[model samples]
Target chain A: MSHMFRLLETGFNPAVFNMGLDEALLRSVAQGESHPTLRFYGWKPPAVSIGYFQGLHEEIDTDACAAQGVDIVRRITGGGAVFHHYEVTYSIVVPLAHPLARENILDSYRLFLGGIIKGLATLGIPSEFSPINDISTGGKKISGNAQTRKLGCILQHGTILLDVEVDQMFSLLKVPLEKARGKLIADIKSRVTSVKHCLPSAGSEPFESLFSTTVGALEKGFAKSLDLDLQRSEPTLKELEIAAELAAGKFASAAWTALR
Target chain B: MKLELIGKPEGCKLLRLTIEIDATAGLSAMALIQSISIRGDFFAIPEEEFDALERALAGVALGKLGLEFSKLARERGLQCAGISGEGLDEIVHRHLATLNERN
Candidate 1:
C-alpha cells in the first residue's frame, strides 16, 4: 500500500518562520487536520539553529551573528547546531501510528533516512547512513538529520548539502577547544562534502540550475523509495496562521532561543 | 562501501561538564562542587526540569553526582536523550582528578 503525502516547496524564509512551519505541520498532522507532509525550504540571510538541548551562548557567537545580519533560532529536535545555508532543508511529519513510524529511535531514523539515501543516489553520489543520524559518502558527512516525537507525530528534519563554506561557519560558531580551532576547521573541511563536489557537471551549471535539478531528483527518489503518492500543494491558511503565531511567539522570541 | 564506524548517534550535540571546585582543599578532603553547568546539544524533555536540575546541582558533593543525578532525574520523571547521568559522572570526575593532580 502506498501512502499519500502533501509536498510543499516553500522557498527561502527567515529562520523563525522556517521552524514555525515545521511545528505547524507537525501539529496539523497530529491532529488529523492535514495529511502527512514533506516540506522543503531554505533560510534567508542564513541562520544558525541550535538543538533543543543546546546552550545558545555555548554554540553560537551572538555578536558575530547580529553584526552579520544572521538569524539565530533553536530547533525542536535534538542534535548538534547546524548552519543553514547552501542546502535544501526538508522536514517530514508522520502519524506515530503509521507503519513507517518505529518506536525505537535508531530504528526510526534508519527507516526515514532511506528516502534520502535513494534521493542522493539519483544525484550520482553513493551515500551511506552513518548511524544515529547522518548520511555520509567517501567517509565524509554530506547530510545531518535530527528527530523528535511531539503531539503524536514524528517530526524529522535534515539538510542535503549542496555547497559548503567551512571557514564562514566556524566564524559564526564558538569553538569548544579554542586552541584547536584551526585543527577542527581543517578536520570539518575534510569530513564534510557537498553536492557541487560530487557532480562533475555542477561546475558548469549555475547554482540555481543545480538546486532545481537536485530537488527534482529527490522528488523522484522519495516517491520511488517510500512508495509515496506525493500531492503538490500550498500551506493551508490555518497552517500559515499557526506558523506566523509560532514564529512571533515561540521561535522568534529571545526566551525560546536562549532556553538552554 | 563497508565503513566499520557503526554510527549509533552521529552528530550528537556534545554536552560538556564544566565544574568549579574549592581550590583551597586537597583531593583527600573530597572536593566539593561549588558550581556545575552541563552545557551541550543534548535533549531533556520538559526543558524546565533540566534547568532546575542544573541549578540544584550546586553544593552537591562531587562523589555523589552520578547517583544523585539519576535519583533527581527519576524523581522529576524527566526523560533525557543524547546524554546520561553516568556519562556526566565520569566526565566531571575525570576533569576534577586532573586538577587535583596539578594541585
Candidate 2:
C-alpha cells in the first residue's frame, strides 16, 4: 500500500519561523490533525542551527553571527551544528507507528536516508548513506541529518548542500584551538561537498533555478523510494497559528537558544 | 590547574571534557578534582537526564571517572547516539594519562 503525504514547499523563511514550522508539524501529526508531511524549505539571511544537546556559546560565535547578519536557532533534533546557506533543508514527520519508523536510531537513519540517496541520483550524483546520519558522495558529505522522537512522532530534518562556503562557515562556528590548524580546514574541505560541485553545469545558475531543480528531484525521489502519494498543499490555519506562537515563545527566545 | 581535552571517537560526534585539578596533588587521586564539564554534539535521551549524569560526575576521582560514568548511564537508562559511556571513559582516561605523562 502506498502512503499519502502532505508536500509543503515553503520557499525561504527566517530561522525562527522555519524551526517553528517543523515543531508545529511534528505536534500536529502526533495529534492526528495533519497527515504525514514532507516539507522542503530554505533559510533567509542564512543561519546557523545547533543540535538540541549543544551549548550555544561553545558551538557558535554570537558576535560574528550578528555582525554578519546571520540568524542562529537551536534545533529540536540531535546532531552537530549546521550552517544553513546554499542548501535546501527538508523535514519529514511520521507517526511512530509507521512501518518505516524503525526502533533503533541508526537503522531508522538508514531507512529514511534512502529517499535522499535516490534524490541525489536523479541529479547525477551517486551517493551512499554513511551510518548514524549522513549522505556522502565520493566519501565526502553532501547531506547531514538529525532526528528526534517527540509527541508520538519521529521528526527528522536535514540539509542537502547546494553549494559550499567553507571559510564563511568556519568563521561562524567555533573550533577547538588544537583543531584550528590549516590541516583541519583542509580536511573538511575535502570531506564536505555540494550539489553544485557534483553538477558543474548547474553550479553557477541562479538560486531559483537551483532550488526548483533540487526540489523537483527530491519530490520524485521520495515518491518513488517510499511509494508515497504526495499531495501538494499549504499549512492549515491552526498549524500556522501554532507555528507563530512557537516562533515567538520557543525558537526565537534567548533562553531556548542558550539552553545547553 | 585547568585542563581541556577534546576527542572524536570513531563513529561518534566530537566530545570535549573540561576539568580543574589541584596542581600540587597527584593526577589520579580522588581529591584532585575540583570541577568537570562535559560538552559535545552528542545525543543522550530523555535529554534532561544528561544534566544529572554531568552533576554526578563532578568531584569524582580521576581513576574512577569512566566507571562512574558507565554506571550512571546504566542507572539512568541512557540511550545514546554519536557517543557511548565507554567511549567517553576512554577519552577521559587517555586524556588524564597524557597529562600524567607530561607532569
Candidate 3:
C-alpha cells in the first residue's frame, strides 16, 4: 500500500510565514499531530533565505534587500543562500521512522529527490538528481534543496526555478569580489535555467498559467514517483496558530536572522 | 605561522581551513585551528554537527588532522555532500606540503 501524504497548496505568502509554516508542519509531524506532508508554496515580495550556519552579512546585501523590499530569513537547513523568487518551492516532512525516510543522508536525498526528477520529467524537462541535493537539467541547476533532521522528523525543502532574474538576484546577494560581479552574474545566468525556458510548448503563456501547469505536473510526479496517495488539505488551525507564533517570534526577528 | 588553505575537492563543496601552525620547533605542528569553514553549494544534515566536527579537530597535529576529521565524522555519523573529511585532509596536506617546500 502506498503511504498516505497530506498535500498543501499554499499559493504565496510572505517569507516569514512560509518558513514558519514549514517549521510548524515539521513539529506537527514529529509529534504525530499530523501525517506526512508535502507542501507547494511561493514567496510574496520575494525573499533571500540564507542557510542555518551562513553569516548573514557575508551572504546577503542588506541595504540592497531593504531598498528593493525583499525579505530575508534564515533557514533551519544548511546550503547556500537562495534568492526565492520566480520559483516553485516545496517542502516535505516525514517522520524518521517512516519507510520513506532513510538513515543515510545521501540515500535520503536520492530517494526524495527522485520525486522531483520525476516531476520535472512530467514537465518535459529531463533532470537528474546531482549528489548532495541538487536537481539539474542540461548540466545547469534547475533546483536546489536543503534538508534537516530534527525532533524525530526530516524536513526537506527546495525550489524549482520558473524564471530567473539574474540582475535582481545579484543585487540582493553579496559578490565574492566586487570586480567579478558581472562575470559572476553572467556565469550564473548560464548555469541556472527556469521551467519556462525549458518548455518550448509553454511559449507566450502568462506566468500564472505556466506556474500552475508546473505545479500540477510536480504534484502528479510526486504521486507517481513516491507512491504517495496524496490527499489535498489545508493547514489545521493548530498549525496556523503555531506558524503564526513562530513567524512572529522566530523567523521575523532580527536576533534569529542575524544569529550567524 | 597561520596557514589559510582552501580546497574544492571533486564532488564536494569548498572547504576552507585557517590553521595556526608552529614551525619554530623544526617540524610543523598544529598549534590551533582558528576556524574551519565549509562553503559552496553542499548539504549536511543536522547542520549544527559541522561545528562539533570542527571543534573536534581543533588541536590535532597537522599530520593527523585528516584522519582525525574522518574519524570524528564517522563517530558522529555525519552526513555530508560535496565534501568529505578525507578529501579535505588531502587538500590540507597538499597545501601544507606547498608551504613546507617554500620554507
Candidate 4:
C-alpha cells in the first residue's frame, strides 16, 4: 500500500501544547486515524525538555525555571536535557507497519535524520550524521534526535539549534565540580556549534527565515525519499482535542514529570 | 567486598559496597550486600565508589538490581537511576572499567 505524508507546521506554541500535539499525533497514527505526519513546531516563552529517564531536580533548576516562566517538560523518548531556545523542533509519526518503521532504532534515526542533514546542507552548512543520533558540522552538534515506539507507532522528535546560549544551558544543568574542572565543559562547548555561529557572515537572516528554509528542505527531502506526495494541513478538531487531553493528563502533569 | 568514599564537603558521598561474594550466597544475598548504603558530599566521593556500587548491584542475578538500585537511590536522596537495567551487568562493568582506566 502506498503511504501518504502530511506536514503540519504549528509555529511557536507553548510547551504544554506542543508536547500534547506530539502525543496526539502518535496516537492518531497508531490507531490508523491519521496518515503518517511530520510536524514542525517551536516553543513560545522557551523551555527545557529532559529525557524520560532524566531527573529534573538534578538536570534542571526548578527555581530558575519558575522564575523565568520557562516550562519544564519530559519527553517520552530517552536522551539528555535539551534547552529549547531559538530552535526548530520536528516530529515524525508513522505506523509501525510502515516499511521504514520496521528498521532498528539506529536505522530509523538514520532514515529520519537524512532529512535533517539534507536540510542543513541546502542552507550552505555542511552537516553530517554522528553516531547514535546527532547531526553535526565539524564535530559540533547542530541537531539531536530521540524516539519513542508505542502501540505499533513510532514517534521521532528532535531539535535543530539556530542559536544556542551555552552559558545559560550550562547554568540550568547540574555539572559535578570535578567533571566541570576538566576539559569536559570545554570539550562540550568545542563540540557543539549552532547554525547562527556557523553563519556569522550571513549578515541578516532572521531565525524564523532560517527555520522556514530548514523545514522547507526537510519537506522536500521526505517527499523525494519516500516517493510520496505531501500535503500541508491543519489539525482536525479531534486531533486538537486529543492533544489537549494528552497535555493535561501526561505532558503537563506532575505525575508524569515526577516519574523517575 | 569493597568500600570507597567519594564527593566533597557539603556534597560529600559515601558508599558501603559488597560484591562478587561466593555463588553459595545466592543472588538475593549478594543483592542484599550490594544494596549497601550510598550517601555523602557530591564532590568528595571517589569515582571508584560509584563504579563499585554500580558493578556490585549490576552483578545481582535475576535483574532485581534495577529495582534495588531505584529504591536505594531514593533512600539516599539521590534522584534518577544512575545505572540502566538494559544489559545491566555488562554496561555496569564497562563503565567501571572505564572509571578504573581513568583513575
Best-matching candidate per DockQ? 2
lDDT per residue (tens digit) for residues A1-260 in model 2: 99999999988999999999999999999999999999999999899999988779889999999999999999887788899989999999999898877877788888888898999999999999987789999978999999888777889999999998999998999876444342255565577899998998986799789988999999988888988999999989899899999999999999999986
Instruction: Give the docking tier of candidate 3.
Output: acceptable
lDDT of 1 at A89: 91
TM-score of chain A of each: 0.95, 0.96, 0.95, 0.92
Give the DockQ (2 decimals) of all models: 0.27, 0.47, 0.37, 0.07
- Using lDDT, give the best candidate's number: 2
lDDT of 3 by residue, A1-260 (tens): 99999999989999999999999999999999999999999999899998886678878999999999999999988887899988999999999999999998888889888888899999889999876778989988899999999898999999999988999998898755421342344565577888988988776878778778888988898898899999999999999999999999999999999876
lDDT of each: 0.80, 0.85, 0.83, 0.67
Off by over 4 Å in 3: A175-186, B1-5, B18-27, B34-40
TM-score of the A chain in candidate 2?
0.96
Q: Write the per-residue lDDT of candidate 4 for residues B50-73, one digit (tens) a residue.
A: 434554554444335446555544
Q: In model 2, what is the error at residue A86, expressed in angstroms? A: 0.7
**Residue by residue across B1-76, what tens digits does model 2's lDDT show?**
7777678766557887777876576556454556777777777765667778877787777667667777887898
Give residue A90's error in model 2 in angstroms: 0.4
What CAPRI class is candidate 2? Answer: acceptable
Q: TM-score of each model's B chain?
A: 0.72, 0.79, 0.77, 0.31
Candidate 1: where are CA atoms >4 Å away?
A: A178-186, B1-13, B18-37, B43-61, B68-81
User: Number of clashes in every candidate structure?
Assistant: 1, 0, 3, 18
The model with the greater TM-score, 2 or 4, is: 2
lDDT of 1 by residue, A1-260 (tens): 88999999999999999999999999999999999998888899799998887779878999989988889999988777898888889999999898788877777778888888999899899998987688999988899998888777899999998988888888898766532342355555587888988887786777667778888888887788888999999999999999999999999998999986
* DockQ of candidate 3 against the true complex: 0.37
